[model samples]
Target: MPLPTQEKAAGMTTRGGSTSKPEKRQSGCGGEVKDRRTVEDRLDELLSSMLTRDYLDRQIKQLKMDIHAENKEITERLEGRIYELETDNEDLRKTVGSLEKEIESLHAARDKTEIKLNDLEQHGRKDSLRIIGLEDKSENESVEECVEKIVRFVTDKLEVSLNKNDINIAHRLGNFTRTKPRNIIVKFTSRRKKHDIIRARKKLRGSGQVIFEDLTRNNQQILKDAFRLKCVKNTYSIDGKLFAVLTNGKKRRLFMDTPLSEEYLMNDGNFRRL
Candidate 1:
């Protein structure tokens, strides 16, 4: 007998095959289904990876924006603070300038007032003289009587005549002390009488008696310093100007407002140089 051919539904036959055709078709279909599922899974993974990348990109962009905003805010705050500080500094400068101007005005006013005060003081003391070496009287004797007796004695010693009415006022300068007698201050009615008394002052030079012009405290200190200088002699002040009689007999004018220094005292020509 001849080999039999097996026929299937689509008119296909297999000769001496162990598997049926239907089974082969089933296997091919199963393989196609598996390949399709693998392709779908790979496509899903690709889509997920792309979505994740997009999300990461968005997050990174947002973070960058936040950083930029914070930086901008900080910069604006710093700038504002700087501006405020600059404004404050400008106002402070203006205030300082105003204060400086005010201080200068006050200084000028003070200087003018001081000059006026000094002038008044000088005028008030113009007709005054100071007499030294007069002994303090006992409590029983009146001060006025003591002054009159001393004045009479001074006039007699100088061989000059002075009227009792010439002295407007006479008194000791301070309280009496046991150690030393206070100097007598005399105010004359007429400037002529004062000049006469001063002219006659040389008569009492070696007699331990002294007559001095009633100068201001400042001028008195200047006179004392001038007398203390080694090279100076016959130191005197006239009209607030200090004068010194040099050892060489030359008269030199000194700066009354400034203190006498060793440099000024040592060199006789220093005043001239000034």
Candidate 2:
């Protein structure tokens, strides 16, 4: 009976020891699982930081590209505006050139017309003469008869014969009034006959009657001014020009186009530089 009891006790002790070993192994497994969980959390944090940095870098690069595109667009617009202004400036230059040429052509045309009008006026009064200080005609006598009588008197005084056909037209210049009898204007058939009458006018020096070449209104004014000078002996108009005979027997020619002022007359009509 004693041997059996001892065997039973030994069996109990062996069973207790096995139970303690299994408890220790379970604690060590719990500690290993906690450490694995800590390592996984750290890995997760690192991945999140890398994703945020990549996103920020992409945004910065995109911003730089947008700025470059905007700058390029502004430059193109400025260049286009400059080209437009240059084109407008060139067109204005051409317009100014055309206007200047037109003004020059107008000036040339005006000068040519003035010269032509002067020639026509001078040719119209070629064969006419003016007779001053003639006696008044009688009331019963016709104007033609009065003119014939004057012509006969002139021919007798000059000792030169003149035909009736030589005279084309003769008449008083203005109305025949009781107070003032107008001078006579005569047109001759030929220029030679008119010149002959002018040459013969010297024969009637003492006579009250005076004869002159028919002058334009402008020439008449010039002659009247010239005759006012003390040095001027005689003044005559021929072919639209005035001839002044000085008391010293020198001849001076004057044009109707040039006006004679008081200063010029005071200088004895010496308009030349000499």
lDDT of each: 0.74, 0.72
Candidate whose TM-score is highest? 1
Show the lowest summed lDDT stretch of 10 residues, model 1.
19-28
Write down the lDDT that model 1 would get.
Answer: 0.74
User: Which stretches of model 1 miss by more than 4 angstroms?
Assistant: 1-61, 139-141, 222-235, 239-274
Candidate 1: Cα lDDT at 95: 100
Q: Alpha-carbon error at 191 in model 2, in Å? A: 1.5
Q: What is the lDDT of residue 118 in candidate 1?
A: 65
**Candidate 1: clashing pairs of residues:** none
Give per-residue CA lDDT, model 1, range 120-208, as digits (tens): 78678889888888777554456577668666866787767776688888877777776777788888889887787778888897877
